[model samples]
Target: MDKSDITLERLRSFVRVAERGSLSAVARELGVGQSTITRHLRELETALGVPLLNRTTRRVSMTDEGARYYANCLQILRLVEQAGDEARATRGAPAGTIRISCTAAIGVLHVTRLIFAFQDRHPDIGIDLSLTDERVDLVREGVDVALRLGPLTDSSMKLRNLGHSRRLLVAAPDYLAAHGRPAAPQDLSGHEGIRMTNVAGSDTLVLQGPDGARHTVPFGGRFRVDHGLAAREALAAGRGIGSAHRWLVDDLLSAGRLEVILPDYVPLSVPLNMLIVPQRTGIARVRLLVDFLAERIRAIPGIEQTR
Candidate 1:
């Protein structure tokens, strides 16, 4: 086997193809032609003296040897990338792409603007932002950091607690005028309830009173949504009353499009956290973005810092 013939390019192509299970898909992802991907695989296999992939017309599967090699390659590539990151970090100007993951609603409503500002400060740095509500594996996805809402499940990734995201029950002024404003927690069930389909027990509204009381009220309505932005829109349209993160509807509230109902009561706050891949903690660009985001996110309208 010719070890010298095995290059980073070949390893990267092999890794992408193995993960995607489609040579053509990997080709498009890498912005290269299928022929080039095929050649990379061929050369890699020749250099290793092993058949790496079992390719048929429909799909590609990794050989046992390929699977083992793929795992090792992931570590090797990560180390190489880490070395590059550290080297760049030591220079005068930090430069490299930072991959970030965030929930779609916050990404669109707030985080994107912060990212734009971050770019303004560091022109050489590039950002690859993935907007999704699903929890993604940062290492598997090659993400540098992720801004996550609610409680987290994974213990492997490093954590930075941003704070609890404060929430409130709100309705449009037009809706209030048509349906009558809810005077208290009991009055909420009589009015339409715009609940989240994604959240567990969203049909039940839990509010903490200013007097240190917890109110559990049955909540339901004609409109149920999974996305935060959708919930904000529904509230603005006066479809129903629902809980919204303060950051999600601050503008509408300020504009009088949406009004807070039951001012004495507040919905349960969700935890907002930043998760970083263990290997990326020391990278300068990652650290810069992480610190920048933490500071900016805390300064947001309804983000309450935790002790």
Candidate 2:
């Protein structure tokens, strides 16, 4: 085997292709031509004198040997990155790109502002923020950290509980004028409820009463949306009363565009968590940003620390 033919770039290309299962996707991610990715794969395979990836027209699958090699390559790349991080940390301010993933609405409303402030404070550190509602695999996607809402199913990653996202029942003034306001939990049954199609129990609303009792009521509407922004827009447009994260409609509430419906009754709060890849947690930039976010996120208007 020609050991010299195996390079870091080739290993990275191979790993990305293996994880993403698309040569073209890897090329786009790395900002290189597809031919470059193909050549790197070819050279790496030639050096090892074995076929690592089985390339079909539709998809790329790794051979048994390729899977093992991919694991090793990931470790090698992480070690290399950590070494660079340590070297840079010792010299001065933490300087490196930290990739972060967050839910779409939170990203747009609060996290983006926090990130901007963070960057201003530490100009040397670079941040890459990806906003998506879908839960992505951090290790596979090369994401350093992720901010997630609701309970996390995966326990393998390092976790920090920022707090719970406070939710409120809200409606526009005109909506209340037309449908009449709900005075209590049961009053909701007679009203049209704007629902989220993506949430698990969109048809049912679980609210915690002021006296600490739980109330489960049927929630349905003619209009259903999958995105928080869309739901906020629907509420603002006087579509119907709906549950919203306090941060999502805080501006509207302050501006009197939306009013709290049955202020004493509240929807069940969802957990807000920060998840970090085990290997990336110790990197200087990653650690710094995590700390920064943890502190800042707690201060958001609608975020409250769990007891």
Candidate 3:
């Protein structure tokens, strides 16, 4: 028989005999009889074309050839162990491509940065991101992970709380200085406002004032956009006083390009969540990406910290 036909059982028996130096001792450890151990060793020796052991009635030892063969077997066994470890490591690590979807505004403001950080840590992992304002079916679209804002409607998908973002009424410093800032929620009626439409085509703004009273402001603008990013760009260009997630305009606010119109009347913080299909929960790549994004989103400036 060729070397490929040699059985691991025979190699194990030879190693046991070489280590114990006695057929009876090796057989005892292997849970086999002494004759059985001798037969296995003979089979291995026959396959290798080399006598592997020096056998005697009083004692057993390795011949010169047997010593060399045992040395080779030891090296092979060590290599086998190393190969098994590498396989296990690949299975546990995040190494596959993950599909993700998010709104254009959030994607540009937050998700894009997190994706870059995740890629830096796991270079082997590929990320496919689809940015749109439309509500996408996670399973139908074949998305592995999704970043969603506000309340979620689909109960079938698994949701993990990432953090929360406050909707702030903001305007360009020039616009606010020219038209003057609204002193109260009711004052927005006389001021020019910008509105964003969701998939449902309805728009509503809710705010919580310093007096601990919740105010729902209902208004329509001369200009309406379907995406937050477009609405933010319009607001930055001095279109009108627009409301957007605080996280999205953090840089603009910090640089004095945009100013919070109503500081005392801040809107309610909307929960931001990471949604994943239930079937993908156990997948190593999906789980790793979800966890990494959750931690990073929570650290974003102006967003509520998650516990």
Question: Number of the top candidate by TM-score?
Answer: 2
Clashing pairs in 2: none
Q: Model 3 segments beyond 4 Å from truth? A: 1-93, 199-204
Candidate 3 or 1, higher TM-score: 1
lDDT of candidate 1 over 17-63, digit per residue (tens): 88778898778877899999999999999988999999999999999
For model 2, the run of ten residues with the poorest summed lDDT:
85-94
- Candidate 3 lDDT at 208 equals 88
Tens-digit per-residue lDDT, 1-307, candidate 2: 9999999999999998998889988888899999999999999999999899999999999999999998899889889988988787777777878899999999998999999999998899888889999989887687889999998998989999999999999999999999898878988988888998889998989999889999999988899988999999999999999999999999999999999987788999999999999878768788889999999998887999989
The 10-residue segment with the lowest total lDDT in model 3 = 196-205
Taking all chains together, each candidate's TM-score versus the true structure is: 0.90, 0.95, 0.68
In model 2, the runs with Cα more than 4 Å from the true position are none
lDDT of 3 at 79: 60
TM-score of predicted structure 2: 0.95
Model 2 gets an lDDT of 0.91
Ordered by TM-score, highest first, the candidates read: 2, 1, 3
lDDT of each: 0.90, 0.91, 0.78
Clashes of each: 0, 0, 0
Write the number of the candidate with greater lDDT, choosing between 1 and 2: 2
